[model samples]
Target: MGSDGSSSGVVREPLDYVGVTNRTSSGFSLIWDSPEEKYKNFVVTSKDVGKDEALKPKSTNKDSEDDSEKEFDNKEEEAKYEQTNKSESENPRSKDENRVPESVSTPDPQNKSGTGSKPVTGSITSFKKVLPGSSRFFQFEDLPPQTEYTVTLLGKGPGLLSRLHKLVISTGPEPPKDLVFSEVTENSLTVSWTKPKSPISGFKVTYTSIKDGEPVSVSIDRGDSTLGLSQLSPGSSYEVSVVSILGLDESDPITDFFMTLPDPPTDLRAVNVTDTKALLLWRPALAAVDKYAIVYGSGTDSELRVTVSANAAEQQLSGLQGSTTYTVTISSQLGSNESSEASTSFTTTSGSGGDGDGFGDLQSKDVTPRTARLSWKPPTKPAGSYRLTYQTEGQEVKEVVVDGSVTELNLSRLHPSSRYTVQLQAESGGRNTAPLSTHFTTDCSQELLNGILKSGEVDIFPQGRSGPPVMVYCDMETDGGGWTVFQRRKDGSVDFFRGWKEYIKGFGSLSGEFWLGLDNLYNLTSMTKMTLRVDLRDQDEATFAKYSTFELVKRNYKLIVGGYSGTA
Candidate 1:
């Protein structure tokens, strides 16, 4: 090595790079960088210096190298020399600073030996060799383990004196044994090993994933024989190798394999919840896992688990009790080991609105030829509203929305003797109650009487009027049952019996509602038309003068009127 701007000469012109490389216990490799210009020859010397020789003060008498050997022979002076050498290296004189300049500097004397022991400068073997400049490596074989060695290099050039290069290096400790898993967690693991019998600097751990690529490595202090490995893959197997490092070298790698449990599932949540069923959704573990287990139950119920395939993102849980709260947990598994569980809880909604047996005691009353009245008792659980729907046979249904309190409704315009079906239901909370249905038929007596009167023979005033007949309203119940009319000829005969039915049928347009002149009743004296007011409830026969529906035929017909009428 050359001194910094102090000494103008060069030692082998200073190597491009020079140190120990590929070192191990029992042996180490010494390498020196080749120079730009090749040398004809080179020499490597390894000296086995005793501890006493290395610790003794250097010979201040430049005249005698033999004085250095003599100082090591005296035990008491050797101890005093050891202390003085330490002080001189710490506060070196200007003369010593000028020797190597900044190219050489001592390590901290406090850490002169790594474990506070006196550091030696040699191994048991001494090697000296003169080899060609082509040589790049010198392997010092079968050296003592954990011993320090001082190596010197010299290169011979043309017309140049070979210069000396010095380096000190130590061999590594022995390899560790019986490395194994001491503790494990989801994302971390602890590895333990037997401490090497020989001293060591630290432990170097290199781990490889059983599932993927290149091994990862780390270094830890020697005091921690059991070291924890973190940032490890969950649910994965790995092979880890532990090596002991001494000084700047490492021992052989000792390997052990281990597996870590998978991490818990993430982003747990629930969706599509119902009274009796729910769907649970979650994100699968990022790492590889074999399967998943889903466990769910209410606080008061026994929990149950369902196994699902890996990569599944959701599960449907059914048969849940209505209006209940439940807790659910999701866990991922790799073989028999399962990761810590991820959990979520939710409450179900109340059961959906239902239809019950409402609208009871349904009936139809006050039946008529064309109308009916319906009534019913309110249901036990009255709803917000009611729907009353009714229909004749083969007709579209008609419905009325009513308050729940309404129990009676009038259904009108029904055909005589035709059957109608009525349905009733309660409505509450946007739901419909069970329907109560019943059947009803209108009274047929009115139609039967109407037909009888219509079938009678027709009689006309012989003016050939083809237009529709004049109209009149009939109270079939009162008029037809009593069956009377103010029908009589001037000659007084029962022949007006035919007039009761026939003339009444011609009064279809209500033309018989006006007054009748009894002063000259039935006078056929140049009248264009005539009307009759009739009421037959007086219990009269065919000769009755005031009947509800009465009729006749004659020439020059004049209008006549009787009972149930006002002034003309």
Candidate 2:
């Protein structure tokens, strides 16, 4: 505070604690603590602020400038007077005068003819502006942070007098605010923020994935408020933080959380095919999904839908039509949303649809040099009849047609000990199933019997035995087809079965070294021997009865007569 421009016997006290507090990036709180205040204008001045600063130099160097201005004016006047005294026609000066010694004609600063100009005065601070204030405090806003500001508070006093107080203060830079995320994809994210109140050097964006446990950071210029982060993990949660920086100081950070979507399913396929059922499988989602949804159908009108657990990678659909093509769409579902669809198509096994053909097992036995016996039942599908087509080397195809009721056929005229390709296909409604194929060769010396195996049981023997051989035959039969032939092991354990279908039909193998028997033949007495003979008592009926066993000897193989031998 100050008094009027008069020697009045009065002393005015200064406003108490007139300073700044609560300094921020762009502003600070200015306090004028005086209770009684009467002023016309509040003049505020902010000096040049820097990180490392001493006292700011004065704005104008007046004293030295005034002295230099006077000297320069005196010289300029002396040169002008000399030019006026000499014309183009003036006599030459004396040689002594022309050769005047150095420093003899120097101008003096006290010359009355020189114009003495007063040096200009400038304000002492870098940034000065007038502000309005009343009461005890004035909030000084919009000042730069991280800088040194020497602010002088001024007030108009009585008459032409003014009161002032000089202070050094600076505001802190503003921190970035309201960070948001957009355009979030499996591998990247875009984040944006609102600019703060004051200018800053830049911003520091720090982000980290919770699943990966790694953090990344980048610097953004002051002109840019958005940052794009790339190379991120899919279906992962991340935390992002944005902070404003001014010089070496940084504002408090603002943070947010987000997650990337899981990738779509890949490599979809079908398996375990049947007329009415099929199994569907696919690779798991690349990232993660709440669950999976499948839209499947032959077409749009009959579309069907199903849902699977998030971790499930496969599904099975039943009640499908045989040989009918189906289209399936799979998608990764997250929350209330689902990803783009991945599609695939497949057709069920054809030939048989609905309950057309029942289950059946095929087997073969009694292979000779020129003939092989093949037996089957329960058509994969119902059909009119069975056809056994066969041929030998350089021979015409010979086909044997039989009623659908028959199940066994003997393939003849095959080459001796030669391989032949065979096809077994199920037929229904004039449509043939894709043939199930096999290969077998005619025997060299061994002979086998021909018979139907509808009951899953059969008896085999050589055609008219004449000499000792390496094999023995068992002609046992069962009601439930319970007695399966057992194969003997070198260790003496009958743990394996002789698969006759494997040997004759080329389904598998049965060597001469393995023993054969019905492990559980409930229809026969334990180790009991039986024989039968065929007879026709009526013109329409033919049946078989037990026959007597023949006493045969062969040291190479002891043939056990344990099964029926009958004619039909």
Candidate 3:
């Protein structure tokens, strides 16, 4: 008898051949030849080796059974099946033991034949029955990717030992995971992903522009996990897909969406500035945008941000501080994406008298013990009149109005050695410009006989009452008070090694280290008999040097002293 357990002359195997065809990531097909003799039916079973639980056989519907019986009735279907089988047979990998026929009995855990035997267990399985003269082809569906499956086919007949044809096949690789997009710009973007654990030869990447509906594709080696795409439109959207690939197989594509950055606004500038507001202008961006974002602030201050319609070419900023410089930045935006920033700077006019106005510089000259002359340049814009106000701390403010054509004023009745703040404003047609302000101290000699004893900066007219005021430091507490300080070196905040011109005009602040001008020194010493006292200190130690008489001659400010006495 042959392997089919038949008494006939020579019985052939139930199936001549079994091979896999139409393999995919999720499913595959099994094709076999017709048996030598007509059989009641054929039983096919499949098991996933990676799974442990036994799977119940699937019930075949009457329609499916009828379809299977006539599967091979169509000549065209037979020819297609033959072609598929031929191609699979040509592949050397198809000749493995998995594709060869074997002799085996179907296991029945119930032992329905009353035979003493143990049933097979611990395997997930699915079963299908095919009638004789059927298509000789069966398809496995809805299987996991990158999984191994064992499929078996057996012929059933009366009083016959059916031979089994078994084969092992695996689905295609799984798709990539955790896809990400980064480093996006106006014209390019990057995409990356985590490769699947399943073995694969490479990947296929495809991206489509949502605006134009044009797709671009690229192939990448399995070793690479990232790809960079360029030449994209700004402010545009895109859809990307990644698929894992193996020999003659590709996984379902993983898809995602992203956007490119927009172009920034151009030619940003400040068009106008006032004490409380500013107007900014810019050109529109070349790319399409939904809006524009504006950010403005002064030095070290918290910035304020606002947005305007994309069609707007100018923005008005309000509630700003006067006489302060501010920086403004503008950027174009589309959806969640924003473009690079375009920036500019401007300064606002003064808000009030306390803060100087944007008008011309104000100066004080011809100062005396009881009078001062204040002068300024005319404002760039014409004014109807000018208002001048002056006051000292804790004193009532005084005001004076002058014709707009006048730029200088003389004030009288000012206290000797007293500091006064003066404010000047230009008014025209009921509107006034921000005030221009300055401070000045009336002149006083550094002597108790002059009725001045304060230790502070003071204006002195050493060349008599007709000359401009010369500011100097008076040290009233030392040597019975009333000492004029010509030179001081307390802190290193000021640079002393200066050119002759700087020295002639004096280069430091009276509140800090300073040198009284040489010309002032010559005029002062030439006016009165003065005593010189020098005090020096290092860390905690101190010393002094004094001269009973001191004076400076006119030529080159030559110094002369007599009767020196001190601990130095």
Winner by TM-score: 3
Candidate 3: count of backbone clashes, pairs at least 3 residues apart or interchain: 1
Residue 266, model 3: lDDT of 60
Candidate 3 global TM-score: 0.42
Ranked by lDDT, top first: 3, 1, 2
Candidate 1 RMSD to the correct structure: 41.1
In model 1, state the lDDT of residue 61. 68
Per-model TM-score, in order, reads 0.35, 0.36, 0.42
C-alpha lDDT of all candidate models, in order = 0.56, 0.52, 0.68
Per-residue lDDT of candidate 1, residues 1-568 (tens digit): 3422112232224445455655666666666676645665555656554452654334466574222122122334323323433454467573432232122222223442111111123344455555555656566555666666666665555533233565555565688888879668777988888988887789998988775545788889988788888866677789999989875667867887888988777545554555577777665674567899999998645898899998688898899865566788999899888898987765454455523332355556656556777777664566789888887656788989998878889888666545566667677778865555555555322232223343212221221122222112333343344121223223332233344435533221222332222221332111211224333332453322332222222322323232344322
Candidate 3 lDDT over residue span 61-108, tens digit each? 556432111121223322333343345446636542133122222333
Candidate 1 Cα deviation (angstroms), residue 359: 26
Clashing pairs in 2: 24-172, 25-172, 25-173, 49-148, 145-171, 357-381, 366-448, 502-508, 531-547
Misplaced by over 4 Å in model 1 are 1-171, 210-215, 299-301, 350-568
What's the lDDT for candidate 2?
Answer: 0.52
Over 4 Å off, model 3: 1-23, 29-43, 47-144, 147-169, 273-277, 300-302, 336-340, 349-568
